[model samples]
Target: MAQAEGTYDEAQIRAEYADLTRELIARGLQVSTMESATSGQIASLITDTEGASAVLRGAYVTYCNEAKVKCGVPAEVIRAHTVYSTQTAEAMARACRRSYAANIGIGVTGTMGNVDSANPAASTPGEVYFAICTGAGSDARGEKNHSFHVHLAPQPSRLMYKLAVAKEVRDRLVVLLAEAAA
Candidate 1:
């Protein structure tokens, strides 16, 4: 049980997230999140670092269609694009961004492991969508809008898939956050 001495402890401090958090703080940029399939994992990771409050104020877990709508994701976007589509994710990002008026907004929605019964026709297992909207033009990351979708390979378990997706977002955010100073 104690094989690796200093390699994999219970600290669970993801270097990338911590670095991203530091960068955001250094640049005086703030971030907010709206999440679905990945839940609050992205937000959770971002705040893992010290002084994260300087950059991250709050986040939302819109696990259901109603929750997403209640949190500000427009009803029309969900109806037209379905909660699992990139449009919905973009809506989530923009909504959270406006909600907190933060420089960055992170929105993620998807079917992690199961077909969504609420919208089964559009749900594809392991398929997810996420968007990052920034006020880069106004002294933040350059691109005002960025979006991504991924189909996780059939594998280990639900936890693994979620971790994979969270890491995916973290990696992409690293790229985006790096542009803050540029």
Candidate 2:
């Protein structure tokens, strides 16, 4: 199989970002993100389009366990489910929403190769976990609303994986927002 050095669909991402920002602005909703494996690529993509400031509250690049915990991911959850699991991702999402007072919060965590030997909770290379939360309670702990889990087996280049994950996150956010709008 051919390996893509970097295969981000900029046009598609731009369209999605435009639509997402428009809908959020229309509804007076704010969005934020907690990113790990993909670093801040998700937030970067969202902020790339115009009018993003209206809906984007900023993001936390919680690529480390400490950062994730500091941002609102429970330490116990990480211990129990590992930082790469859905549980941690959900917690991260909820925390972002609460901390940023955003209507929508997205958490993305996974291993993008060069796994940290110190973290036994790290997942297989290219395995990613995502959670999108909404209507988070006033409590800083927050609540989980939605989740997406996937593994890009035979993972492409690190850059390709990040782009793929960003695209997935964007696509999922669009669908969730559309559902809420209905």
Candidate 3:
């Protein structure tokens, strides 16, 4: 992909989002999202595409622990593990599916706070986790994909990092949706 001459490669990101949206609708699936750290960037990108309403259900920009709970994420789950863990992502995906009645639900969380050397795990500023919930029955199954410790250099700035993460999430979802359809 040719890099756009801007802070973010908006053209590339939009192209990927369009493809993902097309594939999701073609597969007769709908999607919703619950997000943190990346804020609502992922949700915004999905909705920005035309015909998104056909397969894009809704999104919860649950940037706070309280918001996550209000959005249907179980309190016990968040209490057991902080919002940055894989388990939290799974819970968010499951909750999004139930709340929005979507065929696929995406949950994303990451760290963007001050990095503390004392807490090595919190050092990475762009670590993200994504979960995709599938199936229709009450006992729906979902899969979790982690970006692990993505350490974006300081030059990109926080907004750029978030945009990059949104693009990555969209690209990954496209692959997963295609695989599921196959």
Cα RMSD of all models vs. native, in order, equals: 6.2, 3.9, 4.8
Cα-based TM-score, every candidate: 0.85, 0.85, 0.80
* Segments in model 1 whose C-alpha atoms lie over 4 Å from true places: 1-13, 136-143
Evaluation by lDDT, superior candidate among 1 and 2: 1
Candidate 1: tens digits of C-alpha lDDT, residues 107-158: 9998867888988999988788999998732333453768988877654676
lDDT of 2 by residue, 29-148 (tens): 888899988888878877777788988887999978999988888899999889888889899888898888888889998776556676754667667789999884455454547988
Least well predicted 10-residue stretch by lDDT in candidate 2: 1-10
Q: Rate the local accuracy (lDDT) of all candidates.
A: 0.80, 0.79, 0.70
What does the lDDT read for residue 43 in candidate 1? 88
Name every residue pair that clashes in candidate 3: none
Off by over 4 Å in 3: 1-8, 113-123, 137-155
For model 3, residues 1-182, the per-residue Cα lDDT tens digits are 12222345767777777777777767778888898777888778777777888987889998778999999888898778767677788888888877887877778876654553433553355456667776563345543333322444343577676777677667667677657658
RMSD of model 1 against the true structure? 6.2
Which is the leading candidate under lDDT?
Answer: 1
Q: Comparing 1 and 3 by TM-score, which wins? A: 1
The clash number for model 3 is 0
